[model samples]
Target: MLSVSVWPCAQADSKAQRKGRYLPEYMAHPGKMLPAIAEHAITHYTQPGDLVVDPMAGIGTTLVEAVHADRMALGVEYEPRWADLARRNVEHATDRGAPGYAVVVQGDARDIVRLVGSDTVGKAALVLTSPPYEDSLHRHVRCGHGSSLTHRNPDESFIRFREILEGCYLLLKPGGHLAMTSRPKQCGGKFCDLPSRAWQSAIDAGFELLGRYVALLSEVRDDDLVNAADVPAHLPRHEEVHILTKPANSEVVAQRVTRIAA
Candidate 1:
């Protein structure tokens, strides 16, 4: 487990340079993940030659980091443009001398089986991603601060989130791990407790809580507003990364024991 502030070299790409060109009006603003954060998570949770997956691969940060760390990476992206970018990024970061590879499939993550193939089911060593925060898909907003902004219908958004989590659970091998980054959202001038919602969803999908770590952002603009005297403080400058694991079945456990005995 990394310390709250130990993730080094965390930096955001400028919006002007994110996609290298003007995007279509319908394309949502890119919420690029920090390469350093992905690298740290990959290194901590996976081993060399292990398979790592990112269902909501945004520009391939997780894939690139995984390849750089000598882990085979598989990612699924909804948009073709972003999927292409992810492949380029992964190729640029790949070490030719290493045995690992990266594959990015352009399709909906909710249908991960079709995207990655049925053979990959129950074989991933780690599932890592920072999914789109609730709401603010078509707009840019800080984590947990946007309430009035709307993208997908509320019911649709929740269903998508739940489905994504369930998909992640289904793809993991028994005893494989899941790490996600999210924050409590603010709605109606109060905290919406999204972390708990995500936790419950993961539990419903049969994942056991392993740990939770709070990673603080360097930018305090959002926190400063929460501390303002006029408004009650409801949000924070940090995001929570929830770690979970799929329990190993008895057959899998017996196989492991026999291997150790041999």
Candidate 2:
């Protein structure tokens, strides 16, 4: 458990430069996780050779970071376009001599257990991912005092999101960790506390709440932090990272007891 609350993952570089490690087309994916965020979670939560999985892997950022850190990786993406891109990114990491191996599957994360197969069930050491902000792939508008996005029925979307979290729970080994990053957003003149919603969703999916951490996405200047968004109001300075753990199962506890007795 890291006592520090904020993770300073913001880099002193332009957005294009910061994304240089990924392919050009990957920029089109709106929900892509920051590389530093993925790297920090992987480094702190898992060891070399541990398996890391990302259920909603947009363009394989988590997978790439995990393999680069010498950990095996798995990703599941629903869209065929993004799934293909994820595979290409994994291939690119392999070509660059990343020490660990990775695989990308084209399937819905709500069915993660079946997508990754029974052999992979309960084998992952960490699950790092970000859920989509709303029902849409990208924000309808990037600027303005309030959101210009259309309000759709979020009930179905949230249901699917919870299903994905439940699947992630089943994919992890006993006592494995899950790190998810999300930010609050204004939708249709109302503030949506997405981080809190995600935290509740994890709890409902059987994960024990560990701690909430902040990952800065802005620059520090003159003892003040710059806002990363170009929006005129409700600007975002950081994303909330919620760390949680799957409770150890009876089988795992019995194994530990046996080892101690031996």
Candidate 3:
């Protein structure tokens, strides 16, 4: 029952005021979703004691929030450095006597079922994450061990997005939800609708789009618009989180089982 209705423009708090403040080692970055946003999504989609997952759990934002919200958490990080930080953060959150447990597995999210085990398939209540934004970031930053880099090609990025969604679809129980954070991007003088692309991929991967929430990173100002001929003209300072769900029917479950097995 956490209501996000009050945050039409999204809350603006200094990075120091957020949950990430507890762990200064993992500074807030463009690739990571805000812990506040993740907490809101988790509470809205799942009740206490449910199992929540973040396949691309950078620095354990979703995992820590899930644990604090009294839901069991599972995170998978491809970068070894981030995986290590996530593991430590999870431990830190759990040691505080949070109601639920958290664990991070290091591996490609596309191979999640294999890494986490087939037993978790159809058992998770929610899968939430903010996937890589193709080549959005200009330069890579060192995340403790090494620089964090993602696929730069849009074509490869979309393909990887679909693969991750397909894996997440299998991880959810019938009626379980999948929520992802995405923002529109400017590509070669054209605006790419990543949220829509992800939605189509999720549908093809057997998920139904349920809702969309926009989280503002900063207040957009009219003066911020420069002499640029972009589609939106002024870049949106907000990112979107798309909520999706598996059909709550035995037939859909059967189809998912058949699809995953094959």
Candidate 4:
């Protein structure tokens, strides 16, 4: 396994690059996964022609990155709006000559096993996704007009999240990896440590923890880190990427595969 602790993947041109790859309307998505983060996980955890899935795919960032890296991609999105956009994004990637194929299913991620079908069970090489943050994070403001945000019960949301994680466990190959990115945020003026909660959820879902890495959302300048999350003041400078695997003697199998490939 790759042992890097921090991933300095936020490039200067990240915004422009993302705008160019995705549809204009996708910019409104509340929690879109960074392309760099998706790319890094796909490159390290999967191989060409391998299957990569994103259970809570928002705008298909993982799917787009995976297909561009020559890996088949599958995504399950809860919102029909985002699912349509995700499907269009995959089509856009295909039109741009991405070699690998991709499909986006519109459904709840907790039903991922059924949504993806029995044929796909235990076939995915990697499951990369980022769970949604609190309701406050999803608020959209435009020209001094803010969209109405629905308050979510944290406990209920966490329970659904754990169910989704369990579904992801069933979708992976015996030695497949699950990579998730999340960060802490303020909920009702109180700090909510979602990453820690997600880590526990993965473990409860029968996955063996492998690594915990940081993917920086900021840039280094003049020997100092430039904090990009300035608006909320409490937003984290980096998101935690937790890597876990299905507990099917996966460690030994992964090491053996590494040796064979080497």
Candidate 5:
């Protein structure tokens, strides 16, 4: 088991960066749970020196956590402020007693394959990301002056979302693991349908469903927060974390064989 203690921070390296905590774009943020998530993946699917990638790298919480745990982390953020903030947080984390490698880029995750180099991105052993929802959840109120809602059409959300996932797919080494945090249940006046779409997207993007659980924050109560403003009475304010993996080893091998034969 590779614990966070193995990678103690080294203050000697001068390459520093961060994204300050000036913006609060999304309230349903997964800021602190990242360390546990990264630690979980490291214990189960990776080693002490593997790589972790987060496409939406919101506040850089995930990257900081990965670096503290002694794993290299790569992040892509469409928002410059967020990306810069993430870089700063990562740098400060390593500057502390946490040891590991971290890198953040400001760009669309759809271009990850090109930005990080095709072969390099496709060779990671684990990818952990908290992607944006399909709907324009934050259009009503823009916090921190963050630029999230791309002017794309309805399906464009899913298209780019899947593109980001598939980009991770190509970067994930065989047998590698992928864990994504998503809110699959949205408040739809009379009907709710967040999980089905999420499931469909995951399957279509070449990820094998592994496991999922409610992300119950031990310190905070989300039920009260999400249900604010007299929202749906029946809606349960809970987020489901989908644990998925790169297609199994055998499947990847068979595909390679078929391609070679062709």
Candidate 6:
């Protein structure tokens, strides 16, 4: 295993921007995650020895946990520097007998099938991710993060995020699962719903929702200042965890057609 590097980039500022967009690579610390991502994935989706992937591996938190839990881990990052640091961190974080892991070449998720080829690339098991929010503190979509798969105008993330989902849908083996976290834009109005656009994106990608959980920022971290701001914002706020699964062929058809045909 490669050793971790105590590099300056690994300790970069969270608010750093690239080309006017918030760089997610900068935001990838152990503290930036939603609570349910790790717990739900550990409980419901994966089994030991299975492969677990996080397309937006960030600081390698999910993959780190997956390795500790005995799942082979794979992560993809849009930023080359982050990809390097993540691999380094995961290697150092893993203990003896933890499942093996690898960080692949810096590539676009749009061609995920091409990068990893098959969903079962490393004994395919499950996927867990937290998509980037489209808007910012002022409530308008914040675009410009170079590492996001896509950065559509009038939208937050780039097109690569969509490709990641598409690739994930195609990559999971039959019975594999996916989990993600997201919040709606109308979030602070007391009437805004959990963003269903991501829900629709999952549905379109062919994963079925299993269950959901919500957690407050206080439950995960101390965000008193974020909430105290004059403008309502997502930083240091509550978030929803969405679980999805691709039903096994048996669940979908109730029987194996191949056996009947034979």
Task: Give the top-scoring candidate (TM-score).
Answer: 4
How accurate locally, in lDDT, is each candidate? 0.65, 0.76, 0.73, 0.77, 0.59, 0.54
- Between prediction 1 and prediction 2, the one with superior TM-score is 2
- Residue-wise lDDT of candidate 3 within 114-217, one digit each (tens)? 98888898889999976556435212222222222255455666677678878888889899999877777665567777788877778878898877777654
In angstroms, the error of model 6 at 190 is 15
In terms of lDDT, which candidate is strongest?
Answer: 4
- Model 5: per-residue Cα lDDT over 1-262, one tens digit each: 2112111111111111122222233233323233444455555666778888887787676677677788888888887877777787776777786788988988988778776776574568787765454332222212222345333432556677777777777778877877765543333232334455565566677777776655432223343333323223453334456667776677674574244224
Give per-candidate clash totals. 0, 0, 0, 0, 15, 8
Clashing pairs in 6: 119-171, 149-160, 150-157, 150-158, 150-159, 150-160, 151-157, 151-158
Residue 159's lDDT in candidate 2: 66
> TM-score for every candidate vs. truth?
0.71, 0.84, 0.82, 0.85, 0.69, 0.66
Predicted structure 4: lDDT: 0.77
lDDT of 2: 0.76
lDDT of 2 by residue, 1-262 (tens): 6444988776553254335467778767666677788999999999999999998887898999998899999999877888899998888887888899999998778778788997887799999987556533223233222121112234555667777888787778889998989877665677777788877888777788888899877766686876545323345667789998887976654553343224
Candidate 4 lDDT, tens digit per residue, 1-262?
A: 6455988766553565576677787777767677888999999999999999998887899999998999999999877888999999988988989999999999878778779997887799999986557433322222121221113455667777877887777678997999988877666567778788887888777777899999877777887878654324455567789998976776754553343224
Q: Which lDDT tens digits does candidate 6 get at residues 1-262?
A: 2121111111112232111222244343422443234644654577777778777766566676676677777777666766776676566655344455655445655565566656443245788876654333212344343434433332334334554676776567777777776666533333334346566677666667776655343321252323323224544344566777766775552222232123
Runs in model 3 lying further than 4 Å from the true structure: 1-14, 17-21, 28-30, 135-149, 187-190, 218-235
* Candidate 2, residue 165: lDDT: 83
In model 4, the runs with Cα more than 4 Å from the true position are 1-4, 135-151, 221-223, 228-234, 250-262
Preferred candidate (lDDT higher): 4 or 6: 4
Which lDDT value does model 6 have at 28? 38
